[model samples]
Target: MRILLSILLVLLFVPDWSGEPRLPLLPDAAAFRVEQVVLDRRDPARTKLGGLTYLGGVELHGPGPAFGGFSAMMVEGERFTLLSDGGNIVSFVMGGDWTPRAVRFAALPAGPGRGWHKRERDSESLTRDPATGQLWVGFERANEIWRYAPGFAAAQAHSAPPAMVKWSSNGGAEAMVRLRDGRFVVLAEDRRGSVKGTVRGLAFNSDPVKAPRHGFTFSYRPSRGFKPTDMAELPDGRIAILNRRFAVSSAFTAALTLVPRAAIRPGAVVTGREIARFESPVRHDNFEALAVVREGRDTILWIASDDNQWPAQRSLLLKFRLDI
Candidate 1:
């Protein structure tokens, strides 16, 4: 009996032989290759406030309402899909020359913020289900996510937290991504409670015809000053996050970090790794959104900045090819 008890204790305390911690995930002085940094040269430029530009190639696309506001972006190979946040999810596809293909649009049914108290629609971040190529849009004001299909008219809204409804006016559902599986992970731009500016990663599943379910919840407290705007999982399962600094202070700069995937599970309290910092040349605007793409076996990280309709601030697109 004594020998059996000792063996059990050993099994309980021994480190799992199958797993090892990943360290030094990112190198210091990480060199980010500069791609074409395009300016939103459009007529009536004064009101053409452009934000969040994504580069598929020379086209250098972004979100604008008039000349192309609500023109949000998502990429698949040489083809890129840019959508309008307010309109019926009008999709403008861009191909080889970066010129947009025919426009495909869709609409959504009247629901939570639909009729009387309809919130202004501001789609912030976009992610695709790797398995199905289904599109998910996270709104900045409404604090909601909508799943859409091609050539459709209306989208199916999903269930979001009360915080989304509360912070809809500001930046609500800011950053989100779908896992290899069907579940999703999202982060709020800011909080109203003691944990204001706190980041929560949630995992849930949803269908285009139905609302999403909140399966798990985990909160991550970054270094006091940083706020994550986007997140993606590495091939090996480590989580990579993009941090944005709103204020133009000396300490404000964009950052990239890697954290163990296990550390960010729902209901689990976790922390992240400070792998790289992205600081543009003197006058670049605030970097807001990020997306990861795969070229063959190579992983590429793309970043876009939001020009708050300021002439002095030009929209910027930066790229980094990950070594590991």
Candidate 2:
């Protein structure tokens, strides 16, 4: 009887390693390491943006186990918000020096699934309505999008649009953006239909859940061997997309491309012009987050990497300027 009682106590007190751990509502920030890096080591003194400039970046570390895996981001001046693939939120304010301050961290208030596994909460893309302060997050495995109130207080609505039904479980809705004209666009990560390098793009008339059927399809041609990760809208109304590629020998590379607004219509096969590329000799990682902010006369671009919560890779955030 005593042995059974001891076993019961152990089972009750000890956490089960088989399931996903419950994350805290707000996690404390630890010491984060920031480093000034150059995009091309050969030209470390280059200060120009547009193409690629080596702005300062950071290697974020935290007390909690869920720190990296950032897949999407939104930037408003010095204020930034990041959404991790593991369904965590990391927001902070930074200055021109690229040092983060007033950092805050939290997990998504609600997820699509029962939260039993990480895939069930694989949030890969994010977008925001600046006018209303509403935010939208796209979950991959479930192929659904959830709209949240400002500050992520609550999930207002959710939808699994029919256009995303055929997308691969791990590659669904990898990039999403709300255009200034009030249209929402969602791009699949790995749904190559009839054409190679061609992914499906869905454009919604309004909020997805409210009008799920009011959407049309288009084709997006990413760079060869690369897949679209995130997207942002330029002040000029063009769309900027971040594409990524990974290989066994080359590791990872990324590119930024610009799609003209005129080409984003229904049934159109759209391919953007590559503006910048990050490859060997350039300090690049798994850069998955992209956000654009318009300053006085300059358009600032921000890109962040996902460390995959691995020891080898570092979470890097880079800033640039779009000279267009």
Candidate 3:
């Protein structure tokens, strides 16, 4: 069956979530630095990729071994926050100069975990309320959602939804976005839907962390051979979802797709239209985090990769102008 094949492929080849688990960080803050990278290693002069125009990017370097399994990220203005599946948090402020400021790192104060093991805190998806600065994180294994105060000061509330109880531990909530219409959408990583090659999705009428008892169901089908990893709300209210695929020859590749706002009604089966692809000569890694922001009249996209703490891989952060 296709589901079996997909899971087998992910277990054997995908490093985004299947790679060696990142160890827990110490009580002291971790440290890291960034180095700029090009859009295309084959040709640094290239600037276009599908609907995206490359601005710049960086490869993150941390002294500690447990530094880069980043699965979700949030961006507001020049500040960025990256969260790893193991509950590690890294924050920094960077501008056009490509220099990082106020670089700080810490672990989540609390999670669905008993503060014992990494699997207990397998956070994969994140969305936030920009107006109130509240953040919501979805944890796998436990199939729970947790809300945090601004700046991740503390955990406010959490819940375990009955709908997500049956989702696989590693595939529970992989992509999430807070829509402008006061709804939150979550996409499972590998939970198949009624339609073949589709994953289950849920729309929360309000904050799922505080009221996770109810939601409407839907489905999302990414491009062939790809699964949703992260999502963001576009400036125009559409949804930008990040899908990733792995191949032995390429290592890791990604697809950025867009789903129209009107197509997400309850029980609907939504398929994203491919807007960009990261493959072949284009520089890419296990990109798992996505964030959209607006600057002046332009909408910008920020993407980050989960290196799985592998020496051969990289913790990459990139920015682009969404020309389309």
By lDDT, the candidates rank as: 3, 2, 1
Per-residue alpha-carbon lDDT of candidate 1 for residues 1-324, written as tens digits (9 for 90 to 100): 999897777658753322333111112221222234333333212211122222332313333322123224455664544333343233444343544455444443433353222244566667776665566777766666677654333454455554355663555666777666555677766653235545655666544225354466667666557777777766666667777775655533676777676675656756666755544332234556566667777776655555443444444545456654
Give the candidate number with the greatest lDDT: 3
Off by over 4 Å in 1: 1-35, 38-72, 83-119, 151-153, 162-168, 192-197, 205-213, 250-252, 280-284
Q: In angstroms, how far off is 97's CA in candidate 3? A: 1.0
In order of appearance, the predictions have TM-scores of 0.65, 0.91, 0.91
| Deviation of model 3 at 109, angstroms | 0.9
For residue 259, model 1's alpha carbon misses the true position, in angstroms, by 2.8
Native RMSD of candidate 2 (Å)? 2.8
Q: Can you tell me which runs of candidate 2 are displaced by over 4 Å?
A: 1-26, 29-31, 47-50, 53-55
Candidate 2: minimum summed lDDT over ten consecutive residues — where? 17-26
lDDT score, candidate 1, position 1: 100
Q: Which model, 1 or 2, shows the larger lDDT? A: 2
Candidate-wise lDDT, in order: 0.53, 0.84, 0.89
Clashes of each: 10, 0, 0
Q: What is the lDDT of residue 87 in candidate 1?
A: 31
